[model samples]
Target: MKVIKEISLLREALRDKRKDGSTVGFVPTMGFLHEGHQSLLKRAREENDIVVLSVFVNPIQFGPNEDFETYPRDIERDEQAAYEAGVDFIFYPSVEEMYPHKAGVSLIVNSRTNVLCGAKRPGHFDGVVTVLTKLFNIIQPDQAYFGLKDAQQVAVIDSLIRDFNIPVELVPVNTVREEDGLAKSSRNVFLSEEERQQAPAIFKSLQKARALIDSGERNPEKVIAGIKEELDSSTSGEIDYAELLSYPELERVEEIQGKIIIALAVKFSRARLIDNIIVEI
Candidate 1:
């Protein structure tokens, strides 16, 4: 597995690959290896000739009071996982290398960013789209892969490609979960033992919400209430946001119809976890 840290070197490598007709599949991530990230790498490996994994903790995407400085990082372990997953290249760039001069321009996908995680963490998606655009340009991949855990993020990237006419194909991989149904995330590391035990309630609540919707319960209020109630019982869990909204669009829907997304975020002692389930009704 070759590791490239400089932008020019990475771009030159990509140009050479294109000349050789090698299809590049890129997985851009904020380091901290987990099974969910591995799933993305595996899928990228299967579909493309060369799989490039980037491990840069984007400082722009993190807001003040957020865990940007303290976010997990283990390049040694992540490289092992990526290499075993058949990744071809690892682009490990420094913050200065990524944003040499203050990023004068930003790629803003507005309407899509005004809800969910966006509403809570302002400018979150902007930072995401901005860095992703930079990575796409630098790597010049034929396709890019992202996990479906961040359903809202998937929507934003979808709009970004459509609106900008970027040639790269955007692939959405399914969310990987724990044996007990909790969505696997790097942030899961932040959960203390007690918090980890209570973490499953988030997924359990989603299951309850899905059941309510599947059983002909259409009222959004009722579904939301039931989910809230489940989390309310958790002595260690703190509810962040629980809503049943249209998948991708993220607008609140009164009656569950086609595909609706049940997304939730809860804070444990040290970590904030987000998960979602889609139901067709």
Candidate 2:
């Protein structure tokens, strides 16, 4: 797989793939690739004629005081993983290449930025949409694959496409998980040995929440409370947030009905892990 660092070079590599109307699948990721990333890559390979993966750890999307500099990155590791996962080209751009000057215009996310993880990270999705707008124009992929682990970002992007008329299909892949059900993440390495053991409880609690919903428990408060209670008992990590909201839209519901998401985030000693289950009831 070619590792491209320039926009011109990237377009050159993908030019032939598109000249004959080949379908391109784009997977945008920050490095420190894990099984979760590989799952998205593998799915892209299955569905598209050419798979393009971008490994730029976008600096703009990270907020001040958010520890963006410490975000894990290993391009050598990611390169090997991408090559094995069947990526045709890796668009690994530099920050200077992506952003050369202070921006005069910025993309502002008015809605969907006040809940879940977005609530705390101000202007995060605005940066996401801005960079994504540039990437979408550059790659022009027929389909873009995103993991549902960051489901709120997916929701924001859904609005981006709808509101902007971007032609690419938005494909939301299921979150990849460990054998014990802890969601696979780059941050998993930060977990203490004991914290790692307690981590799977996050997903377990979400599973229990789904079971409650399936059992005809419709009240949002009851479902969220049960999820929190289980986490409180099973794990020592501080519960970051456990919320029930309408899927994709992510609005609160009076009662759990139709498509809904039960999402959770937990702060371990070192790692902050998140997981969610979406169900239609």
Candidate 3:
């Protein structure tokens, strides 16, 4: 596998590859290889002619108080994982290469930035959309893969692709989980031993929300309350937000009738974990 660190080189390589109609599958990641990332790579390997995995830790997507500096990185480990997963190219660019100058214009996410995690971190999605636009333009892959662990990001990307008419397919992979139902995350490492034991309850509460919806509970308030109660009783973490909203659109619903997401974030001692279950009702 080739490791590309320059934008022009990647662009040239992709342009040449496109001449032969090679189908490219791109997985953009802030490099900390885990089961969740492996799942994306595995699926991309299975379905595409060529797979490209990017390992840039995007500086823009992080907030002033976020973990951008300390966010994990081990390119050697990621390289082995990507090679094993059949990745053909690894576009691992530096921040300086990605942002050579101060931004002339930035992509502002007007919608989908006012709820859940987005609500708390203003302009987070703007950074996300901007970086994605750059990657999408640079790689120009035939399809891109993203895990549904951050389903809200999936929703925003859906809008990004449509609104800009970017020629790429958005493939949403299911969240990879541990044996006991804890959603696999790189941040899982930061969890203290005790917090790790209680982390499974995050997914459990999501399941409880699903059960409520399945058993004919349509009131958003009640469903969210039930989810909060489950988290409160079972975990040591503080609940960040437990919301029930229309999927993708992420707007509040009077009654759960269509595709909806029951999502939550919990702030543990050292890590904040997020999980969700999407269901069609």
Separately for all candidates shown, the number of backbone clashes (residues 3 or more apart, or on different chains) is 0, 0, 0
Q: Which of 2 and 3 is the better model by lDDT? A: 3
Per-residue CA lDDT of candidate 3, range 1-281, in tens? 99999999998887887788889999999988999999999999989888999999888888999989889889999999999899999999999999999988879888876999999888789988999999999998889999999999999999999999999999999999999999999899999999999999999988988898889998999998998899999999999998888988999889888899888999998899999889997
- List ranges where model 3 is wrong by over 4 Å: none
Candidate 1 per-residue C-alpha lDDT over 1-281 given as tens digits, one digit per residue, 9 for 90 to 100: 98889999988887887887989999999988799999999899999999999999999899998999999999999889988999888999999999889656667767866667888999888889899989988888899999999999999999888898888999999999999888999899888888888888898999999888878898999999999999899747777888788877888887889888888888788898999988877
- Tens-digit lDDT string for candidate 2 (1-281): 89999999889878877888899999999889999999999999999999999988888888997657888989999999999998999999999999989999888999877888888788899989999999999999999999999999999999999999999999999999999999999999999999999999999999999888888899999999999999999889999888899988899899888998888889987778888988987
Q: Over the full model, what C-alpha lDDT does candidate 3 score relative to the true structure?
A: 0.92
Model 1 spans > 4 angstroms off: none
Rate residue 252 of model 3 by lDDT.
87
Q: Candidate 1: minimum summed lDDT over ten consecutive residues — where?
A: 103-112
Judged by lDDT, which candidate is best? Answer: 3
Q: Each model's C-alpha lDDT? A: 0.89, 0.91, 0.92
The residue pairs that clash in candidate 1, if any, are none
TM-score of 2: 0.98
* TM-score ranking, best first: 3, 2, 1
